[model samples]
Target: MTPHISRKTRVTGAALAAAGLLAAGITVGTAGASTTQTSAKSAMPIKLSASHRAELLRDASTTKAQTAKELGLGSQEQLVVKDVIKDADGTTHTRYERTFGGLPVLGGDLVVHTAKGGAIKSTTKASKHSIKVASTTAKIAPTAAAKSAQGTATKTLSAKGADAQTPKKVVWAASGKPVLAYDTIVKGVQKDGTPSRMHVITDANTGKKLFQYDEIHTGKGESQYSGSVELGTKKDGGKFTLTDDGRGGHKTTNLENSENGEGKPFSDDDDAWGTGKPDDPQTAAVDAAYGAGVTWDYYKTVHGREGIKGDGKGASSRVHYGDSYVNAFWDDSCFCMTYGDGEGNKKPLTALDVAAHEMSHGVTAATANLEYSGESGGLNEATSDIFGTSAEFFAKSEKDPGDYLIGEKIDINGDGSPLRYMDKPSKDGQSQDNWDSNTGGLDPHYSSGVANHFFYLLSEGSGPKEIGGVKYDSPTADGSKVEGIGRDKAEKIWFKALTEYMTSTTDYKGAREATVKAATDLYKAGSPEVKGVEAAWAGVAVK
Candidate 1:
C-alpha cells in the first residue's frame, strides 16, 4: 500500500482510455479482447533508442486499431490519441494512451510520428515494457475493499471526513501486473487547514493499495479584482441555472461547506450578480462565473480558441469548497473548476486569474495531454500560469492588473508576498531560475520556474523593468541580456506552440522548437518573436 501525489487532474489512465480517440476529429473503433497476445510475440517493439522510434510507427494505418495491430498488441488492448500535430515538413505527431483488457496503463503513453502521406515514421514511448497482466477478477469482497480504501484515505487525509465517493472499478496498469482496482475519492480537510480530496486506488483481488493522488491543488490569489464584466448565461425553463449555453453551457454552483452533498446551482431573478462578500454564497459564484466568461472571451478574442476543449463547448466552475480550505483545482474527471473558500471563508479562490489558471489545465489536457510529471509536468503547470497571466491582462481589470507575479492577491503564504516571480523565480527560495539536470525532481510548481522565466524574458526582456504597474528585475543564466518582443507577441507565439506544435512528451527543448516554429509561422523566420523566443530559452539555459 503506497501513495502517490499527482497534479489534481481527472486524467487517470482509465480516463484517457474512456475518452477514446477524439484528437483527430475522427470517430474510430477501439481494439477489444479478441486482440490479446503476449508482448514476446507482439510486433510493437517494447524499447526504442530514439525519441521517436521509426520501426514501431510504420503501421499500415494510424488508426487506434491499426496502431495496436501493428504493435501486435493483445485484442484487449486499446489506444486513445489525445493530440495530433502535423508539421510543415509533412510530419505528423500523435500523442496517445494505451489500455489493456479495458484497463488504463500508466506508463503506456506514446507519440507516433508519420510522414506527409500518413506513412508511419517514428514512435516515442513512455515505457519500454509491454502492458500484460495475468488476471482481472477480484478475490476480495467489495465491502472489504471499501473499508480498505476508506482506511487508507482517512489515514492520508488525517482529518474528520464523511461518506467516501463510491469506489469505481478501474484496471491499475501503471505498476506491477495489471489487476482489478477501485478508485475511491475521499473528501475532507486536514488538521492543518488544508482541503483534501484524496483519490485512493485499491486492488480488488489482493486488496493491495495500488495508488493514491490528492486532488487539493493548492493556490490562492487576489487583491482588488473584479470590475464590471459581461457574462454569457443560459435560461433553463423559466428559471436561470447559471448555465452559459452560448459558450458550451458553462455553469457555476455552490458547495456551501464544500465538504458534502451535491452542489446547488446558483439561481438569480436578474442577470446582475455578486456582492463581493463571502457571506453571500453567490459572491464566490459570481467571481467564478465572471472569471470563466473572461477566460472564454480571452481565448476567443486572442487565439480564436472556442473553449478549453476547442469544441466551442463550455466547462463549469464549483465555488464555496471545503470550509476554510485554501486551494483551487481543475479536474478532467469532472471537466470543471473547483475552488476553496479560503482561510476564514474570506478568500474565495475564484479570482479571475485563478479561474483562468485552473481552466487552462483543461485546455492543456485537451491539447498536448502533457504527462503531469518531471519536465513535461513542469510545462503543464507553466502553461496554466502563462494563460492565467494572459487572461488577467486581457481582462484589463482595474482591480487586478496583470503582472508576472502569480497568486499575488490570495495571501496563500499567510503573508502579502506573491506565490512566484516570473522574472526572478528564486525570490521564493525554492524554484530554480535555471534548468539543471536535477530540475525534474522538483515539484511541478517549482520546476515551472524555467519556463516561467523564459516567458518573462521573452515578453519583457532582462534586467530592471516595469509592466502594467509592477516592478521586475529579470536575470539570465548565461550572463547574456536578451531583448523583448512584447507580451502580445509572446502570448500569441506560446499559444500557437501549445495548440499546434507541442505534444504530450515535449520537454523544454521541444518547447523551444515549438515556439520557434510558431513564431516562424506567425511572423516569419527573422521576426522579433522568433528571435525573442530563441534568446529567451538561452536565457534560461535551455539551449
Candidate 2:
C-alpha cells in the first residue's frame, strides 16, 4: 500500500530574491536547469500542475496554497517533492507530494520515492542541490594584434628621463580589417596662451604607450587634434577619436586609415556595429575611455566610493548599440552602458553628461535600489541626469562644457538645441520644474525636473545665471531667496541621501527630507550645508 500525502510551503518572489541573494542555488540533475529543488527527506514527489509553475513564475506575491488552488489542488496538499521529470514518453511531469509526515523543507533538495508496482511505498530525500543557470554575455571587444620589434604587437613603451622615444607603442594590422584605438596625449598651446594637452594613445590591452600625438583646432577655431596609434586588430577595424579641451574649448576628431575600407552608416536593427560609421575605431575607443574614466572618478572622489560598487572595478561602455539609435541606456543584464549615433544633427550620444547619466544608473542600482516606475522612479531618473550634468561640470572638459542642457552636442533636433532644458522647465514642451500631483504622475524623463531643477537650484541658485555662453533664470516657490551650493557639495548631499535615507516610493517631498536629514547627518541641522538643501528644494518649488 502507498502512503500518499500532499504538503506545500509558500514561496514568494521576495523570498526567492532574498534566498537568491543569501545563498545561490546548487548544481542539480543537469547543468543549466532553471528549476532547482530544495530540502532533503525521503518523501513522495509533491506534484504541482502546470498552472502552478506558471503562477509562481509570474506572480511575485503568490503563495503555495494560492498556486495550488489555481491549479485545482486541495489547500492541504503539501508539496513534498517537486521535480521536473521526463517520463518514457518524454512528457514532463512536475512531481509533488503531500505527506502526512512532512519532510524537512529546505532550499536545494529533491524527493525520491520507491515505486512498489504502481504506487509509491517509501520516500527519501535527495541531498544534492539544484543550481540556477547564469546568463552568459558575449564579449564584443576589438581583436588585439601582437607587437613586433619594429612597431606593432601589443608591447609597452618605456619613457626615458628628459628625452623622447620614436614610436611610443605600435601594433600591426591587416590591410583590410578595421583598426580602433585612441591617439596618445601631447602638449600644445592655446590661442589665449593657455597650455593644452591630448593624452598619448595607451595600449588598450596592456595600458602601455602606443604613440605620441598633439591636438589641433579646426573649423571656426574649435580645439581639435589629429593622430593615430596601432590599436592592433583590423578584425575590429582601426580609428582614433579624440576630445581636446586643453586649449580653450571642446574639439572632437575622428581619424582613420584611408586605406581601411569605408564602413557603413548606423542603423537601428543592427546589433553588432551599433550606429556610426566604422571609419574610425579610434574615435569610438576615445569616447568609450573618456566617458568611463570621468564617471569612475566622479563616483570615487565625490562619494568616496572605490568604483561603482566601491570595488575599484571599471565597467564597459559600448560606443555603438543599434544603428542611429540616438539614445543611450544602461541595461542591468549586460551591466554595460550602450550609446548610439543620432539620425541627424544629434551627434553620437557619447557626451560627458550622457556618459555620466548612464553610469549613474549603475550607482543608483548599487545603492538606493529604487524601482523605476513612480515618484521614486522619477527621482531615480533625475538622479542620473543631475549627476551626469554634475560630472560634466566636475570634469571641466574643454571639448564639452558643463551646462544645464542634457544632449546639447548630440543635436538630436537637427537644430543647435539640447534635448532637455534644466533652468527653465517650460522650454521643453513637457518637463516640469514645479512639483504637483500631475507633474509627479508624468513620465520620469519629464517628471525628472522636480529633482533636476532641485539639483540645479541647489548647485546654482534660482534666478539668472549664465554658463558657457548659455543663459537662463530659475524661479523658486514660496519666493524664498537662497544661494547656490555649487555642484560639489550638492552632489555629495544628494548621494548621501540616496544611499542612506531614500526608498522606492520616496517623493519630491520625501527627497527634500532625505537630503535635509543627510545634510544634518553629514554637516549639521543648522549648518550652512543644510541651508543649501533647504534652498535647493525651495528653488525647485518642492516646499
Candidate 3:
C-alpha cells in the first residue's frame, strides 16, 4: 500500500488539511474454507434476505425531500443524490453529496440506509462537524494569494530541488469554513522523469498557507489476474485501441517510454496483445488494461459501486511510464491511474492487487475524502490495502489467488519478499501491530499496520491461520484470543463504516467505534460480527 511518495506535504510539515474534524453485514460468497471463530451473540439485525431487502425498499420514501429530512440533512444541507443502489433484497442505500450556502462541502458526503417503508434506519457522515463559515469573501487580493502560493510552492520545491507552476483559485469549504483559496498546482518531472504534482492550498482571505498535499499517490500492478481478459476495444480505421467500453470507457494508453504525454493507445488489427515480456511493450498494456477491468469488476460486482467515483465513470490508466520507473500512482487531479515499468521494464508494476490498491485511492477521494495524513492518513492507506485484498479475493483468479501479502509479485524491493504482511505486520520490521498514542507519528504505510492487523484479526482470527495456501500466525497486543467474522462479513463491515460512519478526521479510536457501529447496524448490537470487531480491535491493542 506504499505509494513510494509521501501522502500530504503540509506547509513544510504544518499539517495541511481542514482545520476541522468530527465524528454490515456478514453475507457473502466463499471459495475455500478457513478456520472460523465462534458466532457472536448480538441483538437481531437484518438477515439480508431478498424479501427483507425488497421490503426495506418497498417502503422507502421516494420523495427526495422526505428522505433528506429523514436523514437529518434537510436542515441546512442540500442532498444531491450521487447513487441509489437497491440490493437483491430490495434494501436501498442512497449516496449523497452535500452543499451548504450554495457551495459544495468537500468532506460532507454521506450515505443513508432506509428500511422498508422509506423509514431511515441509519446515516453515515464523512464529517460530523457542521459546515459553517463567518465569511466567504476574500480580504486578500488575488495577487497576494498567488504570491503566497508561489512562495510556499517555491519553498516546498526547493526543499526537493524542483521548480513551480501556476496556481488557480477555488472556493474551499472543506474545513467547514467557506474560504476563498488558491489551489496552486505545480508540475515538473524529476530527473528520472517521475511526474510531480504538488497541490498547495493558500487562503484567499489572509494569504496564509492553509494546507498542501501531493496529488501523486505512489504505490506499486498485469494480465496479472487472468491469463486473458475480455476487453472492450474500439476499432479506429482498423486499429483496435485499448479502450474498455463496458467500464465507463476506461482507456489504457502506452507511454512509449515517455514520462507525461498520453501515449498512443495499444493497437492491433487482430486484437492480440503483447508476449508478456519486456521486449514487447504491449505486454505491460495487457496487464494494465486487464488489471483495470478486474478491479472495476470487483467494485461493481461485490460492492455495487458504479466506478471509482461511483459516478458510472471510468478513469484512464497509463502504462509503461518512464524508464525503469518502479512505482504506480493515482492522481485525482487527472482522475487517472498511472503505472511504470519496474527495474528494467521486465517487472511492470501492474499487478492485480496493485491495480486495486491504486484505484481504491480514487474511491477514497470520492467517498470519505479521508485526509492523507496522521492517523486518518494511515486509515486511508489501510483502506487501500483492505480493498486491494478484497478485490484480489473477489476476482478469485487462478493466476493470483487471493492472499494476505501485498506486492508479493512486484518485487518492488528487488528481493523476493512482499511489500507488507497482514498476518504479522511487524514481520517487515516497520509496521505496527497494535495502536498507541504515537502511532500517528509513524509513516502512513507503517502506521496502517494497526488497522491492517485489526482487519486480519476480525476476518481470520488470531494465532495460527491459513487462507488460499498462505500461512499466518497472528497475535494480539493483549494476548487475547480473537474469533473472526469471516472476510466477506468483515469487508462489508469495513466498507459500511468507511462510507457511512467515519469522518475525515477519524482516527484509530474513531475507526473502532465506526466499525462497531457498522456491525451493530448490519448484524445486530450483540451479534457475533460486533463481538469479533471488538475483539479484533483489542487484539491490535486499539482499545
Candidate 4:
C-alpha cells in the first residue's frame, strides 16, 4: 500500500490560503510576514562538496580502528564505515555497520555525530547492548538450518519449490538480546511474479527459527500512466534507444511478456513513444522510461542525490514482465525495476508513482537498508510511499496529477478505488490508521498506515481538504488538531532522517526520534517545523 505529491503548492507570502494558514496555526494577516521568517529558518542544509566529502571518508576510514574501543564495544567487535554526511556548520555524521568476532552483526548499524573539532557530539544506535556472544561456533549444521529456512519460506510465504542457500553465521541482535545465529536465504517465485529472497535467521545453539523476512518488495499498478510524456533516449545510427544519458544513462528494456531473465533493450526508429493506450507495447515502455527519468530528476533536483545509489550510476527498468502478472518490484540483486502487464496484460504496471515507489526501494537499500520485517518493514514501505508521492508531486504530471492516493491511475483493485490512501490509511480496510501493539504483526503494506497518516498530517494537517481535484479527510489517533509545516519542509525532514539517522532496525519510535532530530538539524530546536513534526507523530500515536 505505497503512495506518492508537487512543490508548486508551496505556501508563499499572502498566498497562504485561509485553510493553509489555519492549518499552520497562523492568522492570514501574519502569514505574509511569517513567510520570510520561515524561509530563513527552513533554508536547505548545505550539501557536502565532493572534496570535503572525500576528506571526511578518508578521516572516517582512518578512525575506524579506534571506533570500537572509543564506543566501548567488545574487543571482538569492529566498525565498518557505510556513509558520511557533513552539515553546513562543520558537523559530521558518520554511519557504520558492525561485525562481532568476524561475523556480520544484524541490526548493528549506528550513526555518530561529531563537532567541528572532531569531538563526539551524539550517537544513535540500532542496538544499545554491548556486542558479546558465548562463542563463534555454531551447533546447528548449515544443511539443517537451510532445510528449516526453506520450509518456512514454502509454508509461510507460499513460495513453491523454494531453494535454500548455504547458511552463513552472523550475530542476531535485532530484538531482545544478542545471540549467534545462522542466516539462510531461500529463493523461489511468489504467488505473484515477484522473486522471493526470504532470509531466515536460526539460533546457532538451539537450532530454532528466530526470524524471517523476504528481501523482495512488491506493489500493485498500468501502461502509459502518464499521457504522452517526453522520454530521454539515445541516438544510435538512424535509431533511438531508451537510454537516458542525462540521468546516469538509465535505460528501459522490454521483457517480451516473459518472467525470466533481462529482455531486449527498447529502441525506436523515431524518438516518439507511446500511443497513450495499452494496445501499443511502446506505450508501456514510454511510461516506464518517463517515470524513471522523472523519479531520477526529483531526487537529484530536490535532494541533491545524483542517482538511486547517489553514485551517478543508472539502474535499468524492464517492462512487460510476465503475462497478467499484476505487480511491480525492485530487485537490488538485479539493480533494476520490473513491471508487469496487469490483469489481462492490458494494464501495464508502468505508472509514474509505481516507478517512483519501486525505485525508492533502491534509495532505501543504499541508505538505511531497513529490514523488510515487522515494524522496520512498515517504515521501509512507508519510506518508499512517502518519496513516491513526493516524486509524483515533483513531476506535476498534467495527465496524472499528484495526490495522496496511490495507484489511482493504475486501477489496481479492478474497481475505480485506489490501492491505498495516505489521508486515512484504513480506507484500504487492511491498513492501520494508528499504531497499536499488533501493528508489527500485520503485513508491511498494512502496518505502513501509521507513518502514512503521520506524513499526511505533517504535510496537510487533519480534517477535510481538496487538492488536485481529489478530496481527503485525514483524522488523528487522539482526535487532536495538528498544524502542518508544508510538504516541502516535511520532505526535507524525511530525507534527512532516512539518510542520516535511520538504521536497519529503526521502528516507529525510532522514526519519531530520527525525524525530530532531522527537523531540529534543518531548523533550530523548538522551531515551528520541529513542533509540527512532533505533533504529527503524536497524531499518529507514534509518540
Compared with the true structure, what per-residue lDDT tens digits does model 4 show for residues 1-543?
211110011111110000001122222234344654554344343444456666778889898888667788878889988777666566777889999989999989998988889888888888887788999998888889999998899997675769999999999998879999999999899877678888999999898999998878888766433334456777766667788877778878898988778789876665666566677777777778777887888888888777787667789999889888889999999999998888898878777778889899999988898989899999999999998888878876554567888777665566889888999999988999999999999899999999989999999889988876778888999999987778887888899899888998999999999999888787667777788999999999988
lDDT scores for all predictions? 0.69, 0.46, 0.69, 0.80
lDDT of 1 by residue, 1-543 (tens): 222211111111110000001011111123321332221112111222222333323332356797667767778878876555444354566667777777676556666667778677666655555676677666777677677777887886667863477777666654555567877777776665555667677888778887665654445554234344455554444445567666667878888775544489887555556655566676677677777877888887777666786656788888777777777778776788887777787767777778888888888878766656668778988999888888877776454556888878766677888888899999988898999898877788999999999999888889997665678999999989988777776887787677665665577887888888767665556655567789999999998
Could you tally the backbone clashes for each prediction?
15, 67, 25, 6
- In terms of lDDT, model 2 sits at 0.46
User: Which candidate gets the maximum TM-score versus the true structure?
Assistant: 4
Q: Model 3 Cα displacement at 375 (Å)? A: 1.8
TM-score for each candidate, following the candidate numbering: 0.72, 0.50, 0.79, 0.90
* TM-score of model number 4: 0.90
Regions of candidate 3 where Cα sits further than 4 Å from its true position:
1-104, 112-122, 151-183, 189-193, 202-208, 221-230, 234-237
In candidate 4, the residue pairs with backbone N, CA or C atoms under 3 Å apart (3 or more residues apart, or in different chains) clash, namely 4-388, 4-389, 5-389, 5-393, 6-393, 222-348
For candidate 2, lDDT tens digit of each residue in 152-194? 2111122211111222222211111112232333333333222
